[model samples]
Target: MDQERARLLASVLAPGVSEYVVLLMEGDPASKARPRFGGGRTYKTAADTAAETATGWALRRSFRQPWTGNVGLGCVFFRPNRQRIDTDNLVKHVCDAGNGIAWVDDAQITAEFGVVELDVEHPRTLIVVTRHVSSLDRSDLVGTMPRPRRTR
Candidate 1:
């Protein structure tokens, strides 16, 4: 995750609002993967099993990298109501988290997903999300995990 960007997001989002840094790609292209919003699977470690249950609207990595060649600490923001605007028409906006926050338009974004891996050295699809902007959430519309009835 980018320290500068993180700080900017923190500033722009509502106080206590959930935010995360995700690696996104466009059509699984190589050499042009950029950071996307927060939302992915839960892994104990970089190679751990995925969480049985999804947490909030996003999933973040365990930790962040500081002054290291390789770092993996992603974030996820779970806002079910946040309008999913078209990437093609995304506007360049900035947040107060720090200074890296910029309005990312759809044309600039290749694809959207929580990062599953981070190959900082090489350009790859390691950074991706299990959920897409199109994926709809049925949490509130339904109940928290369906309940089972007792049978005789």
Candidate 2:
């Protein structure tokens, strides 16, 4: 993604006090799991909500050509199942805030594909959440299962 797009996405994140983790699975299907953290107080931007770089960063798998970039803008809020972080809320918040700048669905994200591309009315300063791929230490195909070759 380009810097402008990245910057715009980051701006709308409106990251709450609670930090998040991006889990990249190799060979695994396109599935997302909730973040794992020690249950505690929910941090807000006003409190000691300083930004920190995410560790254990690495791309655990390789994709074929024509592959789009890995980085995707997402969000989370205080919920009963923090472990199963909700992407739905993030989408709703962004869509509402953006007034149409970004388009998001269960399938894809297109920058500048919606009605309002940025939120100047309710300007939001977002927090960047870097996702580190977790397929490096596992088998070559960390998130994939081998299928028998089919004859035509």
Candidate 3:
């Protein structure tokens, strides 16, 4: 791991939280390709399959057990070029690749955020998984929303 990545991973770590996981995959990030239908079968493209496999391997190396509770997933995609790509597609691939490794299923992810940017020198994907913390659980929610008016 490089110094920047190491610092990032350390920053997300909480002393008592054991469910946090961070994975840094070094390569041009791949988006989730649409499934193809042929010969009466629906299947993923070879490129998509290979990308998912590689992502899964990287995730497995970082997270040993799956998180059973609600999870919050965040990702930062550094692209090799200034090509336009859907951030949703990129996030989808990472979430799907984490199945059975980072979490039991992608549905367990209750919160998600993603960002895509250009990094011609070192393109990579950074993923962070942590236990979901709802806004209701925070003390700073004051004035953020008004209480519902009671109707008799």
Candidate 4:
């Protein structure tokens, strides 16, 4: 991440109220879990580890502030050890881990931005979670409304 962008993020992320956490996970970081039809879920080990890691980090830093309002979020995963991993699954793992610990719930995070890149030197997963505000632009809403035609 660029220094300027980090500075900008720091400005918005007020400590005690809102903040960000940079988690550096060794080796290839695990992705989100998927449930099966037979009342089962895959990657139980991975899921448990992620939850524990996230919660532990949150506890250590006292990131237990549960925000009632809509949250803004951005995450960047520097996955150097993994060859294939979708950003969606990775984000899911992050958001799920952050639930209750970082904020009230993942649903409260209305705004989200995520990026994944390879870092051969680091070979780790870097998660940057920040609070953000949702954009109020209603362009889609305007497009949905019926426009008036001039009959003159």
lDDT of model number 2: 0.27
True-structure RMSD for candidate 3: 11.9
For candidate 1, write residues 1-152 as lDDT tens digits: 44464444333432343443444322211111133444584323321111111121112121121111111122322222334433221211111111111111122222232322233343322221111122232223222222332334
RMSD of 1: 17.1
Query: Candidate 1, which segments miss by more than 4 Å at Cα?
Result: 16-142, 146-152
Candidate 3, residue 112: lDDT: 81
Per residue, candidate 2 scores C-alpha lDDT tens digits across 23-109 of 222221111222344557543332111111011112111211111212234432222222332445333433332211121121222
Clash number by candidate, in order:
21, 12, 0, 1
As a whole number from 0 to 100, the lDDT of residue 75 in candidate 1 is 31
Off by over 4 Å in 3: 1-19, 135-152
Predicted structure 4: lDDT = 0.57
RMSD, every candidate, angstroms: 17.1, 17.1, 11.9, 13.3
> Model 4, 70-122: lDDT tens per residue?
56565566776557778888777767776656655677666666678777776
lDDT of 3 by residue, 1-152 (tens): 44465345434532234556667788899999999999999999999999999999898777756666667787889999988899999999999998877777787677787889788999998888877655423323223323332444
Report how far residue 40 has shifted in candidate 1, in Å.
Answer: 31
The TM-scores of all predictions, comma-separated, are 0.21, 0.18, 0.76, 0.61
Clashing pairs in 4: 72-132
TM-score, model 1 to reference: 0.21
